[model samples]
Target: MKYEKALLLVLAVTMTIITELDLLPQIHRMGFYCGDPKLSHDYIGDTVTARYLLLISFFIPFLILIDKNLYQSSFSTYLLMYITFIIGYCLCISSVNFFKILFGEPRPHFFDTCKPVEALKCTPGSYVSTFTCTNSDLRRARDSTKSFPSGHSALSTFSAGFVLLYISNKASDWKRIVQVLCIAWILSCTVTRIFDHRHHWWDVLSGIVYGMGLAVITLR
Candidate 1:
């Protein structure tokens, strides 16, 4: 069993790395324009690194405390469960990244990144071509095309949903409160992506479904 888990972890990590590498250039492709430049500009939300750190900090203690109170499980058991959660998260993220690259849908703030010169002459709702980004940040320009699915929403939901599933399985008086909080957090994260002009409603909806689906499969 240990060997099997180790092999699974290795495979998940390998696939995630390959997906990340493929994302670089794949995200640079042209995507469907869906928003006006004037209204779409918004500050980028929390960084991915920060979000992951926050979720880890929340989960580690929460899981450990739950295990101690409910099952009196050994440290090694808790550790194994934690590692399993991490692997599940990696798989979920890898799958989402693959879809983002495959779809190549433009973000809400795509115009801010693309800065098409020809767009000046084009009427509102009309497509513009033969343009370049006003900003020299190629990375941001590339990311502008990876907006079909909201990564933030998917990741946030995965983390929250995982915890919710664990709580539901455990006998605890705080389960209801935790469940409500988890659902609220997931909704807020998904909504904020739209407010930040990072994704469309449909993108967020798709992400929610994807994340929840994977969480159910992984947790079970």
Candidate 2:
């Protein structure tokens, strides 16, 4: 069981590193016009930062799991449940990153982040398939291409969905309230992605669906 946990953790970390390191071929190239308004949004900072999101995802469910299982189950049983939760999260995140790399949909702030060198050379109304980013920050420029299936939305929804399912199995007075809050949290995460100019509506929708699907599978 410890080995299984270690393997899942390693797999998640490896997937993230591969995505961050640009190891995979970003074959799905999306074209854009010289002055496309869709890609011209400003890069404001995230409303829910990665650090906070991670903490919320991990600790909230962890505390709930502890409360739910500690009284009735052995320490090993509780530990296994925690491990399963971590594994589900790892898989959810890894899958999201895989889709982001595979699709290569440009973010709303793509132009701002990438600064393609051929923006001036290409005709204003013509579609451009070939261009190079002149941005000094190569990492940011690379990330500008990976906007499909918002990670924030997917992971947030997954965490909430997981908790909702976990608690729903057992009856409690607070279950309905927590379930409502989870749904609301998912909606907020979806909306913020759009307002942040980080994702389109469809991107967020797909993420939510994916998250919920995985959550159901994990808990089942």
Candidate 3:
């Protein structure tokens, strides 16, 4: 348990820095430089949605730990609460960062800092911006390469799908409805990433797919 908390905290901070400093620049060279037009930055504003969602999501695993029924009743449920969550979150986050570095998809917020021309291309090593950063010496503003799949989208759906699986097995219809609504909330949380100008539709889509895939794999 102690190791888990330590590992989770380290990973969380690492992901935050990676998204901020390394990914932002790549996003700047793409089109529109913002999220989809429908949600816009108006009703679906970026800062408000992102801050709340990202912050609140940190507690999900903690809450799972508090729920006695989640693990004590079944072996599979215990695995879902512990092993799957650790592996799923680790894999999804690491994969997103790895692919972002490999794929280099520009973020929607790139327009805020730089001008993105038509069909812009960033040379692999030579970026429009040059910077040096190591793991220990991470700069939040230096996240210039992290816009492949949405981590928040992945995390939310991952937990939601876990809850969905548990709820589906329960005998209560009202509880089932509540679980369904929770799923919708998770989906809306994914949508909020686009509204926040942090990810594109495709990024969110990939995240949703990753999360659902984990849900199914972990369940079976």
Evaluated with TM-score, which candidate comes out highest? 2
Between the candidate structures 2 and 3, which one is better when assessed by lDDT? Answer: 2
Q: What is the C-alpha RMSD of each candidate to the true structure, in Å?
A: 3.4, 2.6, 7.7
After aligning candidate 2 to the native by TM-score, how far in Å is the CA of 119 from where it should be? 1.7
**Candidate 2 backbone clash number:** 0
Which tens-of-lDDT digit does each residue in 24-68 have in candidate 3? 334331223223332122222354354565455544544433344
The TM-score, computed over Cα atoms with residue i paired to residue i, of candidate 2 is 0.86
Best by lDDT: 2
TM-score of each: 0.79, 0.86, 0.58
Q: All candidates' lDDT scores?
A: 0.69, 0.78, 0.55
In the range 162-184, model 2's lDDT, one tens digit per residue, is 88877766766566767787787
Residue 16 CA error for candidate 1 (Å)?
3.1
- Write the residue-wise lDDT of candidate 1 on 81-184 in tens digits: 66787788788878888888778776777777756555556666765433465658777766777786887778778878877776666677666666776777
Instruction: Tell me how far the alpha carbon of residue 184 in candidate 2 is from the true structure, in angstroms, after superposition.
Output: 3.5
